[model samples]
Target: MKQMQIYAFDMNCVSHINHGMWTHPRDTSLQYTDLDYWVDFARTAERGKLDGIFLADVVGVYDVYKGSAAPVIETGAQIPVNDPLMPISAMAYATRHLGFGVTANTTYEAPYLLARRMSTLDHLTKGRIGWNIVTGYLDSAARAMGFEKLPEHDARYDAAEEYLEILYKLWEGSWDDDAVLADRARAIFADASKVRAVRHNGTYYKMEGIHLAQPSPQRTPLLFQAGSSARGQDFAARHAECVFIATPNPQAARPIVGALRCKAEAFGRGANALRVLGLITIVVGRSEKEARDKLEDYRRHASVEASLAHYSASTGVDFSKYSLDEPIEQRSTNANQSALAAITKEASKPVTLRGIIDQMVLGSRMRPIVGSAEQVADRLAEWVSDAGVDGFNLARTVAPESLRDFVDLVVPVLQERRLFKADYAEGPLRQKLFGGRGRLPSSHPAAAFRT
Candidate 1:
């Protein structure tokens, strides 16, 4: 079996995808404000020989449920979040070979500004940065940014397509490879003629300028996207080098992965060019009983209200409006349409409020693996073989504790079986993952814009 890539799935907040797990006695997520927390995390990931840490983010609060923010704020449901990009530099400084995949929505941010920020980080981290492109899904985010409501779902992806064109022009085409001429006699840091301006006038954006910064190590940061809708999947097919997906089971994930690969091939990309990673949470211990006990202990801290608030925001449905046994009626709203669609359309069975709560019992709908290290590794291998997934984005149940358990217990077993890396690879995140050059491959659509 091929070695699997693992990223420490997380967010820069008191609570992330798991919702109310911050109250867990062992969770240190509340220390998100402290720089040391991130630094320590980076070190721990490196020690585990993990590929990277994927940090999820949102620009605004979750105010879709009850049409207000109080539920989110009161339960700490991603409301007290810090900027995802803030702690990354410190984390990079603390560890070598640990990539950072940080999420930033393209809807509200200017392309040039975001490009510069990513380039700066690429330079600082020596090309270990990956950007998870997201179109803002929250109506609250739109309102906060002065819009009446969020743009239609497909329209956002359309806008993102144009956004990527502009970014690619800046990142890959504006400056020639040999543009930088650091010669004292010439007194020229860069040859201006070698750098050209990028001009674009599209339905969503218009820009006429050269790239603001000199090219970093990797001209373009590693491209990642998490969109499971038809339009979203199409967008990922065109531009995403890595794709994130979430499903209730590996059986469910298999067809989605197949469809995504087919879509990528339809867009003239290699079927295997894009790597699909599934979100999963595991609670492994020396024995199955210990793992179950740990899960129960963690459940004592799970906040039902917080989980509901998170679900409400993500699906644009207010769980507070429904009783526990109510069958969740599917309706369109202005949040993560794909997520909502998955629960409603794709599921083999109907999803109910109780079902949702049960799913969140261990943080999201990902199947949990419990038992010894060998048992956990065997399950992961089975998922890889059966689902055709590239790897797993392991979510933390309790802060560093969940991560620590995986590293100390499961990693050794995986390494022993030769299913994971025992040492860091010498390159940027892309090279580390793909075992090729650090930049986007020439076959990628973004590479077509290169000068």
Candidate 2:
């Protein structure tokens, strides 16, 4: 039996994937700006022996729903968001083993600058950091950046390939592992001859500079990608150490998981090279009835309008124009093709305005698992076996409350069943997760850049 890897999925805002849940009396997402909140979150995750805390981010507002950002602002749906990178150092200081997988969009960032920032964080976190690489889909972000429109869906992925290649050169190639000598006897701080400047003259970018920072514990932080699109999966296959997927259920997850692994195999990566995590939300209680009751309580605060607003920006379609019974049309867009497909073309049934609302059971497409500790554990085990996923990026429901319950109740059941580790492994995140060296494997594409 393979032990499952779990990450606490959250965002630095009131409403993340589960929109409108901030209104719940128990929810304290408003404290997102406070460093203590993230520090506490990191501590709790470490206590639960979770693999990491995945912090998601969006560079733009959800204004596509009704031709305005009012609905999103009124409902507090992923708007008023903060930078995910800010709280990381404080959180890293508070926890020992809990990794931090921070989402950063390559669509807007400069490769050299981003590489330096990640390397700095990697040094500070002592190698318990991972990058969730993303090519953003928000037109609002593009407009704010002075672009008339975002690059086409496949075009963005195309640039991302070049972007990551430059990052590999900066992180892995520029600095030799032993560039820092610190030779006090010889009065020399570093071997300048060992460090080389990275030169990239690619289709998307041009750079000729040395990496600002020295090699950290894991020079290239663990790469995590969540591109469910076809081209996206191809990108993940080549570079992603961990792949995140948001599907309706275990059945929906299997094929996507298989596709990514198959693509990875074609790239000459080993079978276990990529760890795929399906997104899920769990509502745990001491009794089955208690969980159901909690589910009802949570649902009462959920806002469908907020979900629509968020979805509009995601799929590049305004849901306000559609009638209740009208079938939503899926068209080619520069936005998240995978997100739109999940509710439209790929759905088991023809999705309508009403169907869209119904599918958002708790203000999210990710339906929650309501059960006792034993039941939650059972569902998780079944997902791993039936879906063929490594584990889940458990969506945060009632903030620290749901996570607290999971660690206290569900973790024990999982450990008893031999489905989860009772203790964490030693070393950097990559080694802890894969049980080997703390850096990219020799077969990995990034390794080719190494000196």
Candidate 3:
């Protein structure tokens, strides 16, 4: 029996992946600004023994459609977003077991600054932190950062490679494990000789300093990346411990999962070095009929315009300019390459404006699973077996109610089938997830930086 991991995929805003279902009466996403909401959510996820709550974020608005942010703003799509890092400490305090995977873009934030923040959180959470690495694709973000245009797709990753190497030097190399000695007589907090400055001069970044904070449980937070393009997968293969893929079905996921593992093996990380998680949304209930009814009810609040606006930003193609049956031009842009390829070159069927709208009827490209707990479990087990993924990242539909239902209703069935854990394992996030040491293993490239 293969065990599966699960994460509650969400954002620090009213609308995330599902587009426009926040208007549902039971949805509590509107209260995202409230500390209580996040704290409570962490508690709930912990109670259900969820592995983690993966928080997605963006630095810019979805302004691609009609070249304006009006539609997204009007629908309250994802514009009113807050910082994903803000609620993490509060959430960690509220729960002992739930891990946090927060998205932070490498393109916009400095490696030196990010390493300290992640180390601080790992210390606070007792090593319950993971970083979802992303490079910005939004022109709006570039504009905000004083750049006239975004860097080319592959060039961003090139810079990221250097960014990561710098982080590795700071996080893994700067401090020796035995440097800290709380010798009462000597009164030495840290051995000055054992700690050294990490200096680097590269094409993309330069830094000369010792790490500000001592090493946390995981000297480096668990690395995660969602890049399905050839270049993106190569980057993920070289760095990510966990890779996220959003495919329509298990079949579509199979080859990508294989590629990720194969690439990891080529890098000498072994085939099991990476855990792949497929993006999914489930609306499970006590019975099949009840689940179907709930899906219909939730579908009533779907915001097609908001979904299109979000998709436009994702693919860097304005759906507003195309007619219903007009073919979408799959032009290369600084945006997400996989997002564009998924609907154009790699699509299972001919994709057009009409097809895109049809897919978004349920909010995003993914089709939600509506079934009894047993049926849902069966589907998930099949997903693991056929897709070769280790788990699924559950996207939210109606906020707390949707997650609450899955935890209360579907978890037990999966547990019974031995597909999900009955309780969390002991240790820091890395130890719990992959077992063994809390720090990067010697085989990992980051370990090369270790003294």
> Ten-residue segment with the worst summed lDDT in candidate 3?
357-366
Mark the regions of model 3 whose C-alpha exceeds 4 Å error after superposition.
Answer: none
The lDDT of model 2 is: 0.91
Each prediction's Cα lDDT score? 0.87, 0.91, 0.91
**Candidate 1 TM-score over all chains jointly:** 0.97
Candidate number of the best lDDT: 2
Name the lDDT value of residue 54 in candidate 3: 97
Cα RMSD for candidates in order: 1.3, 0.9, 1.0
lDDT of 2 by residue, 137-199 (tens): 988999988889989889999999999999999999998988899999999988999999999
Q: By lDDT, is 2 or 3 better?
A: 2
Write candidate 3's Cα lDDT for 1-451 as tens digits.
6799899999999999887788888888999999999998888889889999999999888899999999999998888999999999999999998999999999999899999999999999999999999998999999998888899999999999999999999889899998888789988899989899999999999889989999788989999999999999999999999899999889999999999999999999988989899999999989999999999999999988999999899999998999999888778766888999988888767689998888775777778988999999989988999999999899999979888999999999988878899999999998988999777777789999999
Q: How do the residues 231-329 of candidate 1 rate in per-residue lDDT, one tens digit apiece?
A: 889999889988999886788789889999999898888898889998888888888889888878877777777767777888989877888888888
TM-score of each: 0.97, 0.99, 0.98
lDDT of 2 at 181: 91
